[model samples]
Target: MCEIGGGMNFKRREFLRIVIDAIDGKTESIVVAHKDRLCRFAFDLVETLVNRSGCQIIVANQSKNAPQQELVEDMLAIIHCFSCRIYGSRHYAKEKVKAKRKYC
Candidate 1:
């Protein structure tokens, strides 16, 4: 089933209820636009259900269809964050030392 992820009134209750019904043998197939669309990082549980209960998952957007540019951009953003963390800490320490010392 298709559903919107986030908004001021975002609700995940329907998703949970669907899962419960699937567990109870009411539904066998689940189709989603993307795994991340349902939740940012919580597909393990659904995979576990597939393993245990033999329910099939059909993802509309396969990995091969995903944009390469988005992956590269995400990687660049992560690198930028880590570089800032490392250099920002060093800069803070240097400034702190400069404040304490009159001359070097």
Candidate 2:
């Protein structure tokens, strides 16, 4: 199990690519500091790897075959969705502010 990224350094797309490549026989399981470090994509990626690559992931903090996988995936997805909504709202607010300032 190779840890892919630090908390600040990790990006979702890179993580996905790493997992996909690992499943494609390029590497083994990806390791990370925590379950959330792998983010919302873990559930789908795990299923893909299992179906397509015969690969299994090893989350260093969690045991292999841990029952918590499903729960963790759900939590991560919720957090990601919430963050996206917050970010979208912030962007919308910023745009509105800019337009108001320009028009006024």
Candidate 3:
């Protein structure tokens, strides 16, 4: 009864595969530690799918001492994404310069 999602690539997530299976009548209920722990985004769509299938979505840590954990994690994910975008653009620019130099 344990599933580990390696990263927040929602489309390629193995845990989401399980959720889809459960929604298709393979399981009775879907329990999670935190909603974002399973997905960084599009949780509403997942919740709707689970609801449409009449499956229960249980939150194990709905009440906690540190409520900022979710906020911090989301912030980190956003920052990581932004940084990667900057890195990729820089990399692409360098590659383009190299290509132009080679052509010239």
Candidate 3 total steric clashes: 0
Mark the regions of model 2 whose C-alpha exceeds 4 Å error after superposition. 1-11, 41-52, 63-80, 87-91
What 10-residue stretch in candidate 2 is worst by lDDT?
Answer: 1-10
Candidate 1 accuracy as TM-score: 0.50
- Highest-scoring model, TM-score: 3
**lDDT of model 2, residue 67:** 62
The C-alpha RMSD of each candidate to the native structure, in angstroms, is 9.6, 5.7, 4.1
TM-score per candidate, chains pooled? 0.50, 0.52, 0.59
Best by lDDT: 3
Ordered from best to worst TM-score, the candidate numbers read 3, 2, 1
Query: Which candidate model has the greater lDDT, 2 or 3?
Result: 3
Q: How does candidate 3 score on lDDT?
A: 0.76
| Candidate 1 ranges with C-alpha deviation above 4 Å | 7-11, 65-104
